[model samples]
Target: MSYPHHLGMTVLEAGPERTRVSLTVTPSGLNMHGSAHGGLIFSLADEAFALISNATAQAVAVETHLSFFRAARDGDQLVAVATPERVGRTLATYRVEVRRGAGGEVIALFLGTVSRREKPA
Candidate 1:
């Protein structure tokens, strides 16, 4: 199984310009503070990022930045939505917003850049 599947993440939507992914927090995904680990949140955002970035081209993440605005705990469902900010010939930027539940409060924001790879001959 893919890593996102193993982590209980579900892709709600995927298109060339946008992608949405969701995850329900589990006990094992919690940090010492009883909230969801930052890494787990990052993973969720990255999953959406991966889907949107690769939908139109072969791409790999070159850099990423995430900022946490709130804490999520066990049983809290989180949704990440990724959309392209800019797409260039060789590089692209995407923005991901992770929120509590489907339309709940924003928990984190992630920005990622990807480098497109040349197609194999």
Candidate 2:
């Protein structure tokens, strides 16, 4: 639940292997240039990744790489959908696509990995 609830993030779907999250760009979510902040976009994708990655056990982020295709502006609804690409013994990889609402164009792409933690002694 690391979503920016104060920013009005919406959880469209949450399941074992995939999750969908959304948010509308606003003044607070903007950068100096008046567009949605890149970090904010990344956070949206990361939230989706977090939901799908930690479904089984305690998992923490390993690494992430993101590429922005377009910038979303105020009033634009951004949707992030995360799906598992690989699940290994200890590490898992996921892909998150951030777009402008359903049927909208792709805006950002994110790939992240997380590692499961062992039980405490």
Give lDDT tens digits, candidate 2, residues 1-121. 4346966888899976879999999898999999999989998998889888877667899899999999899999999999989888798899999999876899999999999766354
lDDT value for candidate 2?
0.88
Evaluate residue 101 in candidate 2 and report its C-alpha lDDT on the 0 to 100 scale. Answer: 87
Candidate number achieving the greatest lDDT relative to the actual structure: 1
Worst 10 residues of 2 by lDDT: 1-10
Q: Over 4 Å off in model 1, which ranges?
A: 118-121
Candidate 1 displacement at residue 78 in angstroms: 0.3
